[model samples]
Target chain A: MEVIALKKLKVFLAIASSALILGGCGLGNLSSRPSSNNGTQLTGHANNSNYQSVIKHGHYLTSKSRGVDVQQDANQLNLKSFENGLLDLSKKEFPTNKYIFQEGQHISTKTTEHWLDRKSQNSQGLNPSGKETKVPLYLQQMDEQDFLTQHGKHLKLSGMTVGLGINSIYYYKKKKYGPTYKKSISNATVKAEGHKIGAKVLARLRRKPGLKHIPIVIGLYRQGSDDSLVGGNFFAYSVNKGSSIDGWKPIDERNYVFPSNSGDKGKHANDANDFSNFKSRVQNFFPNLSGVTAQAHYINGSLSGMHVNITTQFYSQTEIIAFTQYLQTAAKKYLPSGMPIDITVKSTEGVQSFLARKSGSKSFSAHVFNSY
Target chain B: MEVIALKKLKVFLAIASSALILGGCGLGNLSSRPSSNNGTQLTGHANNSNYQSVIKHGHYLTSKSRGVDVQQDANQLNLKSFENGLLDLSKKEFPTNKYIFQEGQHISTKTTEHWLDRKSQNSQGLNPSGKETKVPLYLQQMDEQDFLTQHGKHLKLSGMTVGLGINSIYYYKKKKYGPTYKKSISNATVKAEGHKIGAKVLARLRRKPGLKHIPIVIGLYRQGSDDSLVGGNFFAYSVNKGSSIDGWKPIDERNYVFPSNSGDKGKHANDANDFSNFKSRVQNFFPNLSGVTAQAHYINGSLSGMHVNITTQFYSQTEIIAFTQYLQTAAKKYLPSGMPIDITVKSTEGVQSFLARKSGSKSFSAHVFNSY
Candidate 1:
C-alpha cells in the first residue's frame, strides 16, 4: 500500500513539473486543451505573438473607440482564453512583481446560461431576444485607492468598480480532419467595469516606481455583423458619474468616432486633427469669429455627435442666424449624414447654441443660453 | 512727543480692546457694518436671533428645496450679511477655538461693479444694457476632499463651482413705517471658495478635541420677490459633478424644495407633505406596484420636475399606457398643473419610461428601456 501511494505521488509530481516546463518555455498549444470546468474548447494562438497583437489592438481600439461590448459567460473557452490573454498582456506590458489580475468568480446564474445559449444560436446578441445582462469579472484586491498611494500620489485617485463582463463570439470551423472553432474577438464590453480594468492596467504600469506618466486608452469594440477588431478610445471616464455603483461613483465612459482618416495624411494620425480642420473650416467661412473649437464624438467608428464652440468679439442675433445657417451647410459638407451636431457660438456679450439634427436635409435648431 | 505718542497708543489699545470685547459678547450689530473690502455693506439682522433663524431657515430650506438660487454681485448687502450670519451661526453652533470664518478677499472686481450698478438701475439683471456677469469667489485652502474624509468617508464627494452667484431681495417695513428697501442678498457666489468658508466652519468645529459630529448646511437663498426667507438645501452636491474646478472633479451642487414638512411640525414646514400624500394616493390606486418612489424637484417652492420610479411584477404595454393615463389624471388632481413629470416603470422583465409634458392636456410619451 505504501509503495502504491509513493508511485501515485511521483506520477503527479512528474505531470506538474512537465506542465510547468512547457508553460515556462511558452511553447504549448493553449487553444488545443479543453477548459476543464466547461466542456467548450478554446480556439486561438494563445501565445506571445497573439497576446501582444491583442494588447496592441487593445491600445489601438481604445484610442479609436469610445464604448465596447462587455460580454461574459457566453463561451467559457473563449472567455477564459481572452481573460488569460489580457492577464498575460498586463504582465508583459507592465512587468510588475505583484499580480494585479488576481482571480475571483463573478458569474451570475440568472443570465449567463441563457446568454450563452443565445450566443450559440444567434450572432447579434440583440436586446429584443432577451434583457441586456450584466456579468461580473472576478477581481481581487483591485483597490484603486491603495494602488494610487504607491503609484503617482499626485494623480487623483478615483475608485471604480465595474458591474458587467465582456463577451466575444467565435465561429466553429472544420479543418477536414477535426472540428475546431476559429476565434473571433467581437464585442468586449466597455463600461465602468472596463474603465476599472484600464485603471488597473495603468496602476500596474505606474506601480513600477518612478513611472510618472502612462498613456491610458478606453476600449471600444465594433458592433457590426462582420467586423472583427476592436477600436481604442482615448477618453475613458465621463465628465460626470453615470448611473450608480456600490463602492465607486458611476463615471460614464466617453467615445468618439473619427469622420474620415484625414485624407490618408501622414501628418495627422488622430481624430483630433479632423476636429481642428472642422474648426478651421468654420472659422474660414466666418473669419470674424474668434477661438473656434470643434469636438467630435464617435461611437464604434461612426461620428455620433459633433460639438463646435466658437467665441466672437460680439454676438448679434442676425450674425448668429447667419452662422447657424452656415453651420447647417457645414454639417452637410463635413459630417456623416444623420448625425447630431451642437454648435455653440459665444461672445463676451452672450452665448447661443445651434443643435443640428440630420433628417433628409440638415436642420439647425437654435437655443440662446445667454441673452445679449 | 513721548506724551502724545503714549496717548495715541492708549487710544488705539482702547478701541482694539473694545472691539475684542464686543466680538466676545457677540453683541456688535453685524448688519449695519461694511464688508472689510469690496466697498459693500452687509445687511440683514446679523445678531444671534436673526443669524440662528437664517441658519435654521437654511437647514429648513435645504431639507425642502430641490434646486435653489445661487446668486452673486447682484445684492452686496444681503450677500455680505448672509455670509456674516452664516459665520456667526457656525461659530455659535460649533463653539470651537478654531475660527472657521477666516477673513479673505474673495470678491472679484471684474463683474461686481457692473452687476451692482445694474441691480441699482433695473429690477431684473438683464443683459444688452449691461453684461449679466460672473463673479469668482476666492479662497486659499478650500479642501472639500479633506472635509469629506473627516465628515463622511462613504459619502460621494462631488465639487460644483458655480460661475454665476445668488440674489435674495428683502423688504423691511416697520409697523409704523411704510416700507424700506431692506437689502437684497443678490448673488452670494457659492463655489469651491464659498464651500471653503463652510470647510473653515467645519474645521473650526473639528479642531476641538471631543466634537464628534457637526451638523452643517450648504445655504441657498430664496429667489422670488415674494418668497419669505431662504430654504435650506439638504442634498448639497449633485449625485454627479457638473462643470470643471481646479484640484477637484466639478460637482454641481443641488438644492431641492422639499414638498411637505415632515412633522417637527409648525416650527419647520413646507410642501413635502403634499408630495407624500400624492405618493400614497398613487400607491393606493395601484396596490400591486412594487417599490413606488416619488421624487419632486422644486425651484423656489414650485414643482419643476417630478420623477416616479415603480417596480411591477410584469410589464404590459397596454397596462403601462393605462397606468400612465391614471397617473396623468392623478397629476392633474394632486400636482401643480403643466409641470413635467417623468414616470419610470420597471418590472422583472424590463423597464419603460413615460415622460408626460403637460400642454393643454397631459401628453404621455413612452420609451422602452428594456423589453420583457
Candidate 2:
C-alpha cells in the first residue's frame, strides 16, 4: 500500500507542475476578457471627422453671436459646413440652431403729438393766450352732447345748468334735477336745560328753460336766531337751463358749510319756547315742511341734560336759498348781537356732483377725505 | 292757498320748539342700550378667592410630589401656573443630579468592580495579594452553564467550560501521529497552492483503571527536519489520569503551541511532494478519521510554492488533544520560518458546546469585541 501511495504521489506532482507552468504563461483567460468591450463603437473615420467638425462649428457660432472674439488658433467654419456636420456628432453634443427669417414691408405714419394738441385745444375752450374764444357754440353743444352720450347713465345730475353772472362774466353751475325734497321732523320733549336741536333737509331742483344763468343758494338755521334771511347760503349757477349739466342736487351739510358757532348754547337757546320761535321762522320759508317729530336722550342718567333731532325738507333750490337768506336776516335780529355762529352753506350742486362722479362699482374713492 | 300755508307754518313752529328742548336735555337713547338683558341682571361678584385657593393647593401638591419647592409669593404662583414650570426650575438648579440617578441604576455591583480592576490586570494575570483572584474552575463551569442558558443559540460550544488561564503555562512540541498525515501529497496534483495544511491526533488512555495521575507527552514533526528525537517534539503535557480532581480536561493549541522552523522548504525532493507525505502521517494515527480532504493553492505563483489544507473529524477528548499536538508539530515544521503565525487548536467539546449554546436571536461574543 505504501509503494502504491508513493507512485500516486509522484504522478500528482508531475501534473501540478505542468498546470502551474501553463497558468504562468497567461493561459488563464477566465476573468479579464470581457472588460475590453466597455466603450462605445465607432462607425468609421468619416463619422469621427464629421463629429469633430460639428463641435468646432457650434463653438465658433456661439462665440461670434455673443460678440466674443474667437481665438486665432481655433478652427472656424461657414454656416453651410455647420449644417452638414451637425448630424454626425454624439446626441449629447447635437447642435440645435432654429432661425426664422422674413422680408420687411412699408407702411404710412401718424404721430401722437398732432392728436394731443387737438385734444388740448378742445378741452381748454381757449388758446394759450387766454382770450374769450369760443369753440363754436355748436361745437360746444356737440361736446356736451358727446359727454352726455358717453357718461349719461353714470351721471347723477338732473341735467340742468344754472348760470350765475357777476356783471358780464358768467359762472356756470350744474345741479341734479330729480325728485322733490322730502322732510320728517321729531317732536319728543327733552328735560335737559340746554340741548342740541338738529335738522336734516333734502331738496331737489328741476331744469328750467330760457334761464341762461340762474344763480341760486340754499341754507338752514334755527328760526329765532336769524331773521327772515337764511342762516347759511350755498351758491350755484346754471349755464344752460335744461342740459346734461342738470341733475338731482344733493346738499351735504357736513362739508361746504362755513365755520361758525351758530349752534352754541347762549346764542341759540335750547328752551322749548325758543325752539318754537325758531321753528316758526323756518316754516315761513318752507311752507310744505311737515311730519315733524322729536326725541331726547338723557346724558349720564340726568333728566336735565338731553339732545334733540329735527329733520325737514325743501321742495326746490329756489325755496332752499330763499329760506336760508330769510334765516340769516332773522338771526341778525334775535340772537346775542356778537355771537359768531358758523353757518355751513353746502350747495346741493356740489353734493350732487360728488355722488354722481363716484363710480357705482367703487364703495369709496381713494381721494375722499373723512370728516367724522 | 296763502291762508292754509300760514296755518301750516304756525303748527310747524309749535312742533319744532318741543323737539329742540328734548334734544338739548339729552334724553335720546337709540344706539346705547343693550337689547338682550337688563343692566342689573348681568351683575356678578368680581372677587376670585376660591379660584386662588384651588390654584394654591394644586401648586403645593405638584411641588411636594416632584421634589420641588413652591414659592408662596403671588408672582411665583402666577408663573408656576403653566405646565412645565416645576421642570424648568429643577433644570436651572440641579442639572447634573439628573445623570446621577441614571448611572446608579444602569450598572450592576460586580460589573462596577470589574471596570475598576480591568486596567490593573491587563498586563498580568492576578495580583499577588489575590484581591483579583482567578475565578475557580468550578465557578467558570457554572458561568459557562449560565451563559448557555441565557445565550445558547449564539454560543459556538455547548456543555463545556471555557476556562481562562495564563498564557505562559501552555507549551508546544513537534512529532508524528497517524497515516492520514500522508494525504498532503495528493494536493500537489492540482496547480492550486497557498492552501493551509492542518492535522490533529487524540488518544484516550485506560491506564491501570484507577491511577490517580499519569503524565503523557505528545510530539509532532515533519519528515526530515531534525535528527534528535527530543528536538523534533512540538507539544508536551503532564496531567492526572483519574477523575478525583476534575471530570474534564481541555487544552487548546492556540494557547499551547510554541513555534519552530522545519518545513519552510518541502520535505521531499520535489518540494511540492511534501504535501502527500504530511497527509500520510496524519492518517496513520486515526484509522477511522473520515472526511479527510487535501487542496492545493499557488503561493507566489510558483509550482514549488505549494500549501495544503487537511481536515479530519475527531470522536473523543483524548483524540482531540492528540490531534491538536500533532498539528502544532507539523505547523512548526512546514510553516515559513522567522515569521509569527497564528495556529488555533480549539477543543471539539468547545466547538460542540459553542454550537449548541447558540441562540437564534443572539450573536457571538465576537460582536462584543468588534463593538469595543
Q: Indicate which candidate wins on lDDT.
A: 1
Interface RMSD of each: 26.9, 49.9
**lDDT per residue as tens, model 2, A291-372:** 2212211112221211111233322222232333333433333322321222222221111001101112212111100000
Cα lDDT tens digits, model 2, B1-372, are 111111001111112211111111111211222211111100011121100000010011011111111111111211111111112122232232221100011123333233223234433112122322232100000000000111211111111111111111111122343221111212121111101000011122222221113321111111111121111111112122233222122211111001123444432223334444445544543344443222222223322211122333432222333344334444334433332223222222112110000112221110000000
The CA lDDT at B40 in model 1 is: 13
Reference-based TM-score, model 1: 0.27
Best by TM-score: 1
Question: Candidate 1 - CAPRI tier?
Answer: incorrect
User: Tens digits of per-residue lDDT for model 1 on A1-372?
Assistant: 000111001111112211111111122321222111211111111122221110110011011111122332232222222332233223433333321111111222322333223332454222213322222222111111011111221112122222223323333334544664434343333343344444443444344333333222222121111231121222223211222211322322223333334554432235556566566655544545778655444444544555556777533232344455445545545545576665556665334433445334465544322110
CA lDDT, every model vs. true structure: 0.32, 0.19
TM-score of model 2 (CA atoms)? 0.12
TM-score of each: 0.27, 0.12
Candidate 1 regions exceeding 4 Å error are A1-111, A114-256, A259-372, B1-261, B264-274, B277-335, B340-361, B364-372
Worst 10 residues of 1 chain A by lDDT: A1-10
lDDT of 1 by residue, B85-190 (tens): 2332234333322211212112233223332233335442221133222322121111111011111111111121112222334344444456544444434443
List the lowest-lDDT window of 10 residues for candidate 1 chain B.
Answer: B1-10
